[model samples]
Target: MNHLKFLLAIWKANLQSVMEYRVSFLTQVVGMMLNNFIYFAIWIVFFDRFKDVRGWGINDMYVTFGVLASAFGLVSLLFGNAFTLGDIINNGRLDYYLSLPRPVLLHAVSSRMISSGMGDFTYGFLSYAVSGPFTWDGLLRFVLAILLAAVVFAAFLILVNSLAFWMGIVSSFANLMLNAMITFGIYPITLFDNYAKLILFTVIPAALMGAVPAEYIRSASWQILAQLLLGAAILLGLAVTVFRSGLKRYESGSAIQVEV
Candidate 1:
């Protein structure tokens, strides 16, 4: 109940802040949607030339990408502002958060919404609806996959943000990592070579975000379900550990007053 109240307060504050700039929020949301639409368009073009790539068809890849992007979008919508945690640390702006009676990381990360992420969410949901092999079981599996994907994706970002403790400024590095995940990690893992596949499946586990989850739904295997759960747990654990450890080194900066 306490945690729920805290979360509600954070969400309310975010809504108030967002309402102050409604035009920018709406513009960003539409722009984000358009950006993802282009990627879907690219896929259509690719599959036009070749009916199937690998063992999967266009529809199969669409479902995969849609699930992955949707999962990512949900995380971005709620905690996308977590990216700025690093900046707060660097500028000593964390003093205020530290003085508050709550978990600093939670408050800092959930402070704002990503208006653009709504776009990603829309594309993902539409793709899932349109690319129907939909059954009750498939829908259940898809829900589970999205939940796990959000956990894994958020852990990945938290791990990246924790690097701020050492690097002091890592916006560029963080952006690069996000790009790598989208460019290489977002696609099917089976497309890579044996060694690359091993890396994607085990080391980074990017493939599991979509490829493995899609396979589990198609085959309905307990083994895949177990692995996905384990992967999500491991990532969440590691990210938390790193973040907590990193916070020990955080030094608060002077808060400069600004004229509004």
Candidate 2:
């Protein structure tokens, strides 16, 4: 309970700091919305010509985008530092976190919030409102899907960023991996073949990012939901294990400075 309160306090501080610069905050939010809009527009154009690709229609696309956007937004808003973990590790910023009396990984990931994530959250709800059925079950399913997707996304980020301990300065590579996951997640998994699908579910987990959740929502199948839950659990476990193992290899750069 104390840790929860501490996390809330940190989030409140971050929100207040961002709110101090209202224009910059609004610009970042709107800019991300517009950036996401471009991708939706492309999908719209594609669907106009080819009705459905492997049974994935506009509605599937909506669910996919909704899940992915909300998941990404939640992760960024709550754990923005995860996205920059590689840079933080490489730059010796972990020293401050290590000195703090808290779970280092949790503190590090929750210390920052991304202002632009607001737009993604908004976009996700809007997409779901348009594409999903207006029912209690539907809403519950959407929420579940978003939760699972967020876990998968965060796990992937941590798993990739932990490489910094071994490789050092892997910011570019980590970012590329994250971008690739997002890029592949927005599309239909059916578009990929057998081996590609295997990799998507296991190594990258692009399927969990959007595909599996979208399918589960569309079909409401217990099997699909089970797969999503299992996948999320496995990925999360792997991420935590990898990060803790890597922590043993971390060598403090002794970059601490006293502020007089």
Candidate 3:
């Protein structure tokens, strides 16, 4: 309960900060929405010419985008600092977090907010509401899927960024891995071969971020749900372990006199 209150207060402050620059915030939101729309447009055109790909159709694509966008957006909005973990670690910004009373990893990952993520969240829910099944079961599935996907995405980013602790200045590698996950997650998973599928489920785990949850929503099965939940738990545990292990190697630069 205390941690939840702290998180809420931080989020409220972030919201206020973004609102201070209303024009920039609104522009970022609109720009991201337009950018996502353009990507969806390409698929629309493709589907117009070719009806389906490997049994996946436009509706499946809708769910895919919905899950991916919402998951990514939630992480960006609530835990935006995780996306820049490598830079923070490499630049010695972890000192600021270490000074705080809260959990260092949580504090570091939730320190910043991404304003553009609002657009992605809005677009994702709207897309799902329009194309997804309108039943209670559908809504429950959608919510669960989005939550699971967000967990996987956050864990993956943390895992990748934690590498900076061992290998200094790994921001580029972290960014590349994050971008690859986002790019591949938005597309249909069926396009991949067996070996690629295995990799997605294991090393990269892109499928868990979006594809698996989307599949569960399309056809609700206990097996897929179990897989998604178990994968999320394992990845999250691994990320936490990695971050904590790396913290032992953290060397503070003490460049700035930061209170928090």
Question: What range of 10 consecutive residues in model 2 has the weakest lDDT sum?
Answer: 251-260
Residue clash pairs of candidate 2: none
Model 1 lDDT vs. the true structure? 0.76
Candidate number that wins on TM-score, 2 or 3: 3
- Of 1 and 2, the candidate ranking higher by TM-score: 2
After superposition, the stretches of candidate 2 with alpha carbons farther than 4 Å from their true spots are 257-260
Model 1 TM-score?
0.90
Ranking by lDDT: 2, 3, 1
- Name the 10 consecutive residues with the lowest summed lDDT in model 3: 251-260
Clashing residue pairs for model 1: 92-253
Report backbone clashes per prediction. 1, 0, 0
Off by over 4 Å in 3: 257-260
TM-score of each prediction: 0.90, 0.95, 0.96
C-alpha RMSD values across all candidates: 2.4, 1.8, 1.4
Per-residue lDDT over 43-80 for candidate 1, one digit per residue giving the tens place of the 0 to 100 score: 88888887776777777777788778787877877786
Per-residue lDDT of model 3, residues 1-45, tens digit only: 998998999998888988899999999999988888898988889
Scored by lDDT, model 2 comes in at 0.89
